[model samples]
Structure formats: structure tokens, C-alpha cells
Target chain A: MTPAFEKLQKQLRQLPGLGFRSAERIALHLLVEKPARLPELVEALQAAAATVRRCPRCGNLAEDGLCAICADERREQGVVCVVEHVPDLVAMERSGAYRGVYHVLHGRLSPIQGVRPEDLNFEALFSRVADGGVRELILALSNDVEGEATCHYLTQHLPAPANGVEVKTTRIGFGLPSGGGVLYADSVTLKSALDGRRHYE
Target chain B: MTPAFEKLQKQLRQLPGLGFRSAERIALHLLVEKPARLPELVEALQAAAATVRRCPRCGNLAEDGLCAICADERREQGVVCVVEHVPDLVAMERSGAYRGVYHVLHGRLSPIQGVRPEDLNFEALFSRVADGGVRELILALSNDVEGEATCHYLTQHLPAPANGVEVKTTRIGFGLPSGGGVLYADSVTLKSALDGRRHYE
Candidate 1:
């Protein structure tokens, strides 16, 4: 391999989910196998980098102002789903189960990693809540310590609901995933599943 | 995802080994998590696309004239390894086994797919062989039908091994890979291993 090729591979390896071998394969694919696509990929990446920006309201990806979810009139603006990252928001969207918009923290409260409430996109969320249109806030964060801390911090800091109504706060439940067997389920998952059990007819 | 983000994801999805989910993750990683790295990636891609090109002599990646392998004086110029693609060349280089230069066909002879001799970098190879330097032509092509067809085509078209000496054409051997159990080896691999069995110590 040449210096330029190696440099390109190194850059590609820095991306998420790309190992050295996979990065090499991708570099070769772009440089040799389908050379024509390389320019297009570069153009697209530059275009996205120049145009895409954080949604002013929710911290999700946006081009001009708000993200598509925040800008859409059909989505429930009053019901906000809070997630740790944009990918989590994308995952929730993929499920098609949530009709509400999302608030991306970009990170959770990780004390060990020195991540604080101020380090995240918390101020905007607080402002959104304080502005007083939210009816419900669903915490769709991961079932981890940091996620719990973030959820706790958000609930503790929440302002009083508009019109003297109480704001309903909920957390996404943890349990065995679809198509997963109990025998293979971890103990924590099993415990959550047990705690979240529904009454049988 | 916004239009720019979606466009970026679609372009990423077209890359080898990236599925929809992985593409989405990468897009979010660039746009939201580590936005600073996006411009670097774009620059790298642009730089590679601008500077890198096929070595006119051997069809390997090059920045200016000859590829690193071809330009190197220490490498064995007389021994040329022919591979189906640049990634194969990169793989061989990674092993640190072969010290010779390479001839990347960029593709193989796939009659069914309408890949012909003219479609490959055969003429340059023939010219290199005809110009009188190559002593050994190692065929490191794949073990598939098209690979075999390509090897056969190259052997038949080779200009009388320069200086009237034998070209010493050889294909990469097929055998059970290191650390692989014989029982787990597929039938075709088993047959090849048996066929290529070495003499007793």
C-alpha cells in the first residue's frame, strides 16, 4: 500500500464499527474496486458536513433549524422522548412505536468519565420544559447507572407543569427482547422482566 | 434524519460491508457525536481521490508514477504476483510473506459476467513480460472458476518467458488453513489439501 492509501485507511479506521481489516477493505473498495464511487462519497460527506447541524430544540441532526421530528406538525410535540444519543433516537424511530419527538442528550451522566449535567445538552431541554407545553417526558435512556442518573437528574430539575397540571414522567422498561429465550436471558434482564410482569387472564 | 444526513447515509450504505443500521450509526457518529472528525474524513477521501491512481505499469495504486512496490529497488522485480484485486494485494502485503512486486488485474476473467481479457490490465502485464525482466509469475488469483479462467488466459498469452528462461508460473496452494481442524474443512478444501499433500519428512 502507498502512503496516501494508508492515510485514507487510518482515517476510515477511526469511524465507528470499522476495524483495521474492514477499513482496509472499504479503502480498497473506494480506491480500486469502484473508483467512481469514491468522489461521490467524498462529495456527499463534505455536503453533509457543511449542511447538517444540531437541531436547535432537541440536539438531533438538523439541516436548517429543527430536526425533522421537531419540525413535523404530525408528531406529538407535547410528548418528548429523551435519549442519550442521536443513534438511540434513530433506533426508537426505526421501531415505529414512538410518535413523539425526541431530546438527545448526546451523552449521559458519567461521573467516572467526568461527564456532568452541564456537559450534556441539558440547558435546552430545561428551557423546553420551562417554556411549558410538555405533557409527558419518556426517558428512553439505556438501563445503566449513567442512564439512571441522567433520568433522575432530569426529573429532579423539572419545572411545574403548565396550568397547574402535573407532568407525567415515565421510563422505558427493560426485559427480555423479542425472540429471546429466558434461559439465555441475563439475570438483570430476568429481574426486570419479573418486575414488569403483567397479569394473565 | 435530515435530507443531508439521509443522503450521507445512503452513500455510506453503498460502501462494501455497511448495512442500513451500520450506515445510520456512522452517519450519526459523524453528524452528532464526533462532528469534528467528519471534515477530516472528507478531506482524507478527497485527498486520496485526487492523488491516488492506478500504477500505469502494474495496475496497483499509485500517487504519482509507479506504485511503492514497483518503485522500490529492493523488491524482486523479476517475480510478479498476479492478484484479482487491490485488496488481495493488500492482504498479501499484510502477511509480509512475498517480497516481490504485484500485478493487480483489477478483476478476473468472468465469462458469465461478460468480463473479458480486454476488460482487465492484461496488455500492460504482457508488455512487462515481453520487455524482458520477469522470471517468475506467481498466480495468486482466487480458487473460483473465474480465477482459474484468468490464470489459464494469462499462461496461454504470456510472451515467451523473457530471455528464453521458464516463467516458473505457480498458483497459491490450497490447504487447511493454520489452526483449522481437518474435520471442519469443507470438502473442496479437503480435496485440495489432499492433492497438495507434501512428501514425508
Candidate 2:
């Protein structure tokens, strides 16, 4: 292998989910098999790097001041879903189950990992809540200990609703996923599913 | 997702073995989680694109005129190992099973895909053989029909040995792989293994 080829392979191996063999394959695919596609990929990467920035209010990917979700007028401003990462927000949107805005915390409360309140996108969320339009806060975080701690922390620190009314806080449910079998469901999920069992027809 | 983010993800999905979800994950990882690594990857891609090229003699990757193996005086240039792709050459080199140089055909004869001899690096290989230093040609192509057709084509088109000596051409043996059990081997491999079986110690 050439020096430049090896260098490219090494850099590719550092990307998420790519191992040595995959990196080498990609390097060869770009350079040898389809060299014409290399310039397009390079341009795309540079364009993304130059333009993509964090959304000011929600911490999702943004090209300008605010994210599309935050800037859109049709989205419900009175409700906001809180999630651990941008992918979680994307997942929620894909489910078509939520019509409100979102606040990406960027990470959850992981005390063992030394992440604190100041380490996340909490201040903008607090300001958004205090600005008085929000009436509900949906905690769509993961069903884990850290997610619980984060929800607890958020509820404890929430400011009074701008209209001097209560801001309803709720967590997303945990249970067997749709199309999931009971045999594969873990113990915690089974417990939650049982505890939160709904009335059947 | 932002326009730039989606564009980047789309470009990533074009790479070998990457699907939509994995491409999205990699885009988020590069742009949001570990952005500091982006510039390095960009530089590596640019550097490889600008410098790496095919070796004139063997068609392997090269920074300049010749690849490392071809440039090395110690490697046996008299015996050339022919493979279908650059990665195949790399795999053979990794195994440390051969000391001879390599000729990368870039692809095999695929009539359905419209690949012809002119579309490959066969002309340079013929020139290398006719120029008179080669003693043997080893075909390490795939075990499929295309590989057999390519071997047959090469043998038919080979120019008379420049030194007026016979050029012994051989195909790599197909059989049970090392550490593979006989029961787990496919029927074709079992048949080949049986056909190529040697006397026991």
C-alpha cells in the first residue's frame, strides 16, 4: 500500500463503526473503484463542516441561528420534548408520535462520567421555559438510571410557569416495543409494562 | 436534519457497506460528538486524492510511478501474481505467502457488466511479460466462473516467452481453508479439496 492510501485508511478507521478492514475497503472504493466520487464526498464534508452548527435553542444540527424545528411556526410552541441526543429527537420525529418542539440535552446525567448540569444544553431550555409560552415538558429521555436522575434534576430546578401556572412534566413509557415478543423483554421493561398496564378492550 | 447534515450523510451512504442509519451515525459523530477529528479526516482524504495513483507496472496503488512492492529490489519480479483487485493484492501481501510482485487486473471479465479485456490492466501485464524478465505467472483470481474465464483468456493471449523459454502458468488451488472443518465446508469446496488431496504422511 502507498503512504497516502495507508494514511487515508488510518483516518477512516477512527470514524464511528468503521474497523480496519471496512476502512481499507472504503479507502479503496473511493480511490481505486470510484475515484470520481471522491471529490463529491470531499466537497460534501467540507460544506457540512463549514455550515453545520448547533441549534441555539435546541442543540440540534443547524445551518444558521436556530434549527428548522425551532424556527417552524406550525410546530407546537407550548410543548417541548426533552431528549438525550439529536438521534433520539430524530427517532421521535420518525415515529410521527410527537408534534411538539424538542430540546436536545446532548447527553444525560452521568455522574460516573462526570457530566453535570452545566455540561448539557440546560440553560437555553430553562430560558425557553421561563419565556412563558411552554405549558408542558415531556421527558423523552432513555429509560435508564441516568435518565431518571436527569428527569429528577430538571423537575427540581424548573422555574414557575410564566403565567404562574403549573408546568406538567411527564416521562415516556417503557415496555415491550411494538412487534416485540414478551420472551425477549428484559425484567425492568416487563416490570414497567406490568405496572403501567392499560385497560384493554 | 439540516441541509448540510443530510448532504454529508448522503455522501457517506455512498461508501461501501454503509447504510443510511450508519451513515447518519457517522455524520453525527463527526460533526457533533468529535468535531475536532473532522479536519484531520478531510486533510487525509485530500492528501490521498492528490498523491496516490496506480503503479504503472502492476496497477497497484502508488504515490509516484511505482508501488512499494515493485520498487523494492528484493521482491521477485520474475514471478508475477495476478489478482482481480487491489484489495485482493493487499490480502495476499498480508498473508505473507508469496515473495513475488503482483499485477492488479482491477476487475475480472463480467459480460453482464460489460467489462472487457481493454477495460482492465492486461495490456501493461502483457508488456511486462513480453519485455523478458518473467519466468512464471500465478493466477490468484476468484474461484467463480469469471475468474476461470479470465485465466483462460490470459493463457490464450500470452505472448511467447521473450527469452524463448516456456512460462509456467498456474492457478491457485481451491480447497478447504486452513482451520476449517470438513463438515462445515461447502460442497464445491469439499469437491475441490478432495480432487486436490495429497498423500498422507
Candidate 3:
């Protein structure tokens, strides 16, 4: 291949989930269409890059210094949903059930990757909680290993107000499906089965 | 969803092959990453958009006015590989098989998509062929209905050469595989078989 084609292919592979075939498709689509759509795409990317800033208090992406949830005066100030990323915040919002402000962790703590307690936005969260404005600190992090670790770390740093403020961890309850088999269950799952066993009688 | 979230969903859907789930994943990946990566991605998109351009003659994407193949001194001037898109031309080039210059149609004759004969880069092909420099116009279009129709249209437009140059419609042949069945073939394949039938004692 020519230098230009090779360079394009290399750049295309950098995009998330884009393999050789997808890269080729994108390149060809641009070449064949005279690419009237390209300028707009570029403009969108630049605009998003320039304007999307992290909220100073929450760490969520925002067009301004403060995110929409933080800026909105109507949202309940007493509640805060702690999440690992902006997407999780977005996902919860999509459900249309939650109307509280959010705090984005940016990522979870993984000791294997050398990510310590100081590497995350723990300082921001501590300050947000220290003000004592929020009545509840909901640990809505993922159920994965790192997420569980981050939640444990947060609980330690978050000073429990002897007043009315409650610090709680939220989790999606696990149960057997209507048509699941016990024979195929793994060790961890089998252990949880005995711990939370329910009486059918 | 908020207006911003809705806008993001709409933008994700505009990209090729991105379903709602994939879009959500991409959005999450971008948002969760450090602000550093986002800026780099945005810059790359802008850079590619600004630098990539179409060759005036062959309609291939190039960093300059003319593509490398068109400007190359070693390629065969008497032959031109006609393709529906620059990507197909690149794909062929990547395989290191074709050594001739390429003429991109920009698109095929797809009636359902409102792509007419006049919509392609036909005028450029006609002018190049009429210049009496090319001998063979290889129909390297895809083995699809629209590609066949485009090849037929191009054939009718190409007149007898003014000079000693020979004008012919060349095609890469397709036949039954070395270890394949012929009876399961479609009508088009059957027709090709009959037209090129061999004589046996």
C-alpha cells in the first residue's frame, strides 16, 4: 500500500472497536462520498473537545464549569449518586427514575495497575461531602472488583455525620432466574447461594 | 433523557454500523477516559479531515492534487483499473496485484438510491479515454448488480479511440471454484457458464 493509505489505516485502527475491516469501510466511505459529511464530524469533535469540561465539584462532563445537574437549582441537594464514570451517570439518567446530583469517579481503584487512593478524585468527593449539604452519599459504583475496592476506600474516607446524614452502598440484588441450573453454578455463586438461601416452604 | 443526552444518541446513530448499544459503549469510553485522550482523538479527526483530499483526475484520496498512482512514473499508462470507490482501489493496491493507474467512479449506478449515470465521475473517464493514451479499461467494479450496470453504461459512453489506442471492456473472470458445486449457482452464473461452455470429445 502507498504511504497515504498506510497512514490512514494506522490512524483508523486507533478508534475504539474499529478493526481493519471497519477502518477500510470508513476510509472508503470518505473517499467515495466526496466526504461532505467529514467537516461536520470534525467540527463536532472539536466542539465537544473544547466545551466539554469536568465539573469542578462533581467531576462529571459539563459544557461549563458546573454540570447541568449541579447548575440546576431544582434538583435535590440532599442526595448524591456516586458513579465510576459519566456514562454511568448518563445511564442512570436514561432510566428517568433518579433526579439527584452525581459525582463521577473517572475510574475505579485497581492495585494491580498501581492506582492508589490518591490517584482518583477522592479529594473532590471528600470536599463535596464535608460541606454536610448532602443527607445521603449513595455508593452506586459497579459490582466489579475495582468498583468494590473503590467503594470500600470511599466509605473509610467519608466521615459519618452523627447527625441525620446516611452513608450507604447501593447494589443490584442477585437471585436465581426462573429457569437457571444449579449444576452449572460457579464456586463464588454457589457460596452466595448458601449465604442468601430462601425457604420455598 | 436530557437534551444533551438525546443529541449524543442522535450523533452516534449517524456513524456507520453503530447501533444504540455500541454508541453507548463508545460514549462511555470517551467520557470515562482522561480529558487528555479526548483532545487527542478530536485533534486526529480534525487533522485527517483537513489534510485528506480527492485527486482531481482519478478521484482517489490524496494529500496533494494528484494521487501517487496517477503521478507515478512506473505504472502502466495503457491500462486503467475502473472501480466504484477509492477504497476498492486501495484494497486492490494493498494486495500488491494491480500495477496500473485507477479511475474511481465515486459510486455505482444504484437506481434505488437515486444514483444516476451523471452522478458519477464519468466525464473524467471519457476525457481520459478520448486522449488516446489508454489501451484497456479494466472493469474492476464489484460483482454486484449496480456495478454491472455501471460497467455497461461506461461501455456505451466509450467511443472508438482517435489514435492507434485500443479500447476494450476487460473483466476479471469468475468461474466455479476448484472444489465447488455448479448446479447450486444462480441464473447469472448459469448464463456465464453457458456462454463460455467448453467443447469436449
Which predicted model would earn the best DockQ?
2
Task: Tell me the spans in candidate 1 whose CA falls farther than 4 Å from its real position.
Answer: A174-201, B173-201
Who wins the lDDT comparison? Answer: 2
- Across A1-201, the per-residue lDDT of candidate 3 in tens digits comes to 345455655665665677887766665554345367555555655556556677898887777568888988889866787777776676656655566788878777988999888888888888777666776666655556777688778877786554546654443214323233232334454345334432210
TM-score versus the correct structure, for each prediction? 0.83, 0.84, 0.73
Q: Which ranges in model 2 have alpha carbons more than 4 Å from their true place?
A: A176-201, B110-112, B176-201
Q: Score the docking of each candidate (DockQ).
A: 0.72, 0.75, 0.31
Model 3's lDDT to the true fold?
0.65
- Name the TM-score of chain A in model 3: 0.77
Better of 2 and 3 by DockQ: 2
Cα lDDT tens digits, model 2, B43-85, are 9999999999889999999987889999999999898988888
Place model 1 in a CAPRI quality band: medium
Task: Please give the ranking of all candidate structures by TM-score, highest first, separated by commas.
Answer: 2, 1, 3
Ranking by lDDT: 2, 1, 3
Off by over 4 Å in 3: A1-9, A70-77, A94-101, A162-201, B1-9, B31-34, B71-75, B94-97, B109-118, B142-149, B172-201
lDDT tens readout by residue for model 3, B85-153: 765665566555567788988788989999998899998888888888788777766556776677778
For each candidate, give the interface RMSD after superposing the true interface residues on Cα: 1.1, 0.8, 3.2
- Provide the DockQ value for model 3: 0.31
TM-score of chain A of each: 0.84, 0.84, 0.77
